[model samples]
Target: MLPTLAQTTALIRHRRSIKPQDLNPARGVERELVVELIENATWAPNHGVTEPWRFHVFQDEARHELVREMERAYREVTPAAEFREDKLQKIGTNPLLAPVVIACVMERHGGAKIPSIEETEALACALQNLMLSATAAGLGSYWSSPPLLDGATFRAFLNLGPEDRCAGLIYIGWPREGLNWPRSARAPVAEKIVWRAAAGA
Candidate 1:
């Protein structure tokens, strides 16, 4: 179900990045809620009715393969001097902590009627929708795009074409810790808004 405006705003304000380790293993989110979240995500505004978003969901045993791929990519990019075995292990283990990992992708429509940049902006809005839905559903989510996994290698692994772009990875699970972070302050609305009038009208 969709949250009311006030409730949605509150969720947005309270959302924070809960670490993978900080998530509760026994308190996984149900598949039904995940479907609801994706449904809500589709409500985001898209210019010219181009629904460019695609998702690759990873959970349970699938997560192990993802971690293995990510570890391989990480090792390939990391400098040998700075690479620690423990850190690599942690990197591989982190994804397993989350019950689900959502790979958000943008499927580009070549020769799109709308501007290309607007399509990307629309995808950003969809991403926010997903995040807000997660919050409203009582699931903690962290959106991340590691540099090593941002290129063709990752896209190929996920079976994305030349036009498809990897937006980010949404890590979803139950929060182990309470929502305790202070809300980030926003810029003054007056400074951002302006009005124009005819001269001497």
Candidate 2:
């Protein structure tokens, strides 16, 4: 049976990004649940069925691999004079804060029937699905939205084609004991929506 409208709406509204530092490092997201989350992501709608989203999952000690690659990428891009040790420290330790880190990738299917933007939007929907799944599971997940998320260097480290895009990294885990999320509020939709009715017949 499908979820009731109230249940569905509540799930959507409660889904929020929990920062990596707010996650419990000692706990781990089970492998089976991770697979289920990814399955939910794949069910996202895609034009022409391009299915252009790809995921690289890192857990346990393996999550360090992503951190290491990210640090290297930072070094490659940021000049030594401008490099901040504190930022590199976060790159090295942040992934360890979460039980799992999923590297979100977007592959551009060259000359596909639909525009690349459609595929990108499909990927966004897929990420939303995964996030909602995590929320429903009572797990906290964070998706990094940095402007320069793992770029070419880190993509090559992940063995992705150069043309593929490094969207972001999703950190998933249980919230730490003291991690309390404040109630979230949204502005009235009336300020944002503009609907036009039909002209007089």
Candidate 3:
């Protein structure tokens, strides 16, 4: 059966960006569940059916290699005066805190036909779908976008083409025991919207 409108709205509002540290590293998300989430993600709209998103999922020992490459990229992109050892350490450790880390990418498929921005927007929509699905599945999800992801070192590590872009990294796992679900608030719709009446009706 399809979900009610109220159910859909509730799911959207209930979705939260849980940090990797809050995720239970010992609890593993099954491969089938990951595939289901990604399948839902691909349902997101794309211009001319470009279907540009690519997911490189890293788990188990693979996350270690991912962190090593991330550290290398961070060093290569950051200036000497701006580099932080603490940030590097965090980068090296964050992936291990979650059971699944997905490197989201937007591979250019439309060339000059479809704008790159639209492709990126599609990828963003895909990620939103993925996160919503995770929320419904009682899983915690986080999207992390470090500047190092844009660096050539990391792109090369992911084997991305020149036109492809690494959108972000999504971490997924069960929440740790005794963790409280976070609550959030938003500005009133009236403040953000300026609706116009139809033909002075």
Candidate 4:
């Protein structure tokens, strides 16, 4: 179910990360709703329609394959002596915690007029759109990059190329009761924004 405009704003402002265990077990989001959220995400501003965003969604039975690949990658990277049995167990368990795991990949377009950094920033905006849309849809989402960035195992699992970079991993699921937290306070807008006039001219 979608929220009203004011409710949507409130949802976005209050949305917080719920631990995997705190996600509702029986309330997986429908596939159509996921598609809708992604469609809305595309409305974000893009510099040249390069549209470098790519999403690989892992869900239902397909999540098993993703988990298997993640474990394989983890083993490849973990040194024999340093590897902890529990760490491997956690890796195997991570993806199943969410109803949907979205791989947010930034693809490089040939002959891009702007720098690669600009392309990545544009993708970030798209991700924000996705997060907000999920909130409005009564779902909880967490944007994570630790596993995608530091885990060489994760890189191999995704088959990332030289030019391809991971922007984040999005985990979406229904929130358990009392799982939502209040928003963190921000610095004053006056302190963050500045107006420059030429010596009061």
Candidate 5:
């Protein structure tokens, strides 16, 4: 069944990033629920039906591997003088804060029909679908594009091909105790929309 217009708008408005720091480490989201969330992601619009989105879910023991490899890559790439141990610590430990981690990879499908940008846009839409699904499930989630994600070692861990580039890792877990969901202010739609029905009107 499709969501009603009001329900759809409610989801768009209610979706917000719940940072890993604001998530409960003990109360993890179940694997079954995560699988359902990813399935929902596939429903996002894809031009020419390329379906360019690929997700690598990190959970349980594998989450530890993800953090270790990422930290190692960070240390290898960063100059010793510029390397902050605190930041390295985050690379080493942040995944432990979340119940699950999803490595968002984009395999650019190049052909006569669509450009790389369009493929990436399709992947972005898929991610939005994922977040909306997570929110509707009452699960707190956030997409994070950390610098460690760009390092070669991290890519190697993901086993992505030369044409594939990762978007980032998304963290998912239950909302942290005693923390409120974040709220942000946006400019009025009138300020951004330019209605030009006629030429130079």
Candidate 6:
């Protein structure tokens, strides 16, 4: 059965950006649940049915390899004078804090016919779907996109094609002990919307 409008609205509004540090590293999310979340993500709309999202999941000790590559990419991308030791350290450690880390990618499968922006938008929608599903499952999730994602070293690590692009890294895990569900506020919808009516209706 479909969720009621109120339930749906509640789910969307309740979703929050939970950071990796806020997650419980010891509490592992089940493989089946992870697969279900990704499956829901695949249902996101795409123009011309050209599903363009790809996920590279890093879990357990495998995350260490991801950290190595990320650190390498960070060094390769950042100029010496502009580089920060703190940022590099965070890149090396963040993946280890979450049980699951998904490297979301926007693969260019729509070709020249469908614009690249459309494919990227589709990936963004898919990520939202994934995050909402995670929220409903009581999982804390964070989407991290650092400058290293744009580096050639990282792209080559993922074996992405010339036209493909990494969207972000999604960290998924349960909240640590005594962690509270965060509250957030949004501007009124009326402020952002401009309604139009048929003339003289």
**Model 5 deviation from native, Cα RMSD in Å:** 1.7
Q: Could you give me the TM-score of model 6 versus the true structure?
A: 0.97
- Candidate 6 residue-wise lDDT, 1-201, digit = tens: 999999999999989999988999999999999999999999999999899989999999999999999999999999999999999999988999999999999999998899999999999999999999999999999899998999999999999999999999999999988888888898998999989898998
In candidate 6, which residue pairs clash? none
Model 4 over residues 68-123: C-alpha lDDT tens digits?
87677667766789777897787677678888888887776635577778778878
lDDT for residue 1 in candidate 6, whole number 0-100: 100
RMSD of 2: 1.8
Q: Which is the better candidate, 1 or 5, if ranked by lDDT?
A: 5
The root-mean-square deviation over C-alpha atoms between each candidate and the true structure, in angstroms, is: 2.8, 1.8, 1.3, 3.3, 1.7, 1.2
> Predicted candidate 1: what Cα RMSD to the true structure?
2.8
lDDT of 1 by residue, 18-71 (tens): 667767766667888888888788788988778878888888889898887788
TM-score of 3: 0.97
Among all windows of 10 consecutive residues in model 6, the one with the lowest summed lDDT is 177-186
Between which residue pairs do clashes occur in model 1?
A: none
Tens digits of per-residue lDDT for model 5, 7-107 = 99888888899988888888878888999999988888888888887899988788888888988888877887889989988877779889899999887
Screening candidate 5 with a backbone cut-off below 3 angstroms (N, C-alpha, C), the clashing residue pairs are none
Question: Model 2, 1-201: lDDT tens per residue?
Answer: 999999999999999889899899999889999999999999999987778889999998788777778888888878678889998898888888999999888887746467778877888999999999999999998889553465567868767765577678899999899878746788998989988878883
Q: What's the residue-level lDDT of 108 in candidate 1?
A: 74
TM-scores of the candidates are 0.84, 0.92, 0.97, 0.82, 0.92, 0.97
**Displacement of the residue 109 alpha carbon in candidate 2, Å:** 2.8
What lDDT is obtained when candidate 6 is compared to the true structure? 0.95
Off by over 4 Å in 2: 79-82, 147-150, 199-201
* Model 5 poorest ten-residue lDDT run: 107-116
Query: Lowest-scoring 10 consecutive residues by lDDT in candidate 3?
Result: 191-200
Error of 5 at 116 (Å): 1.5
TM-score of model 1 (CA atoms)? 0.84
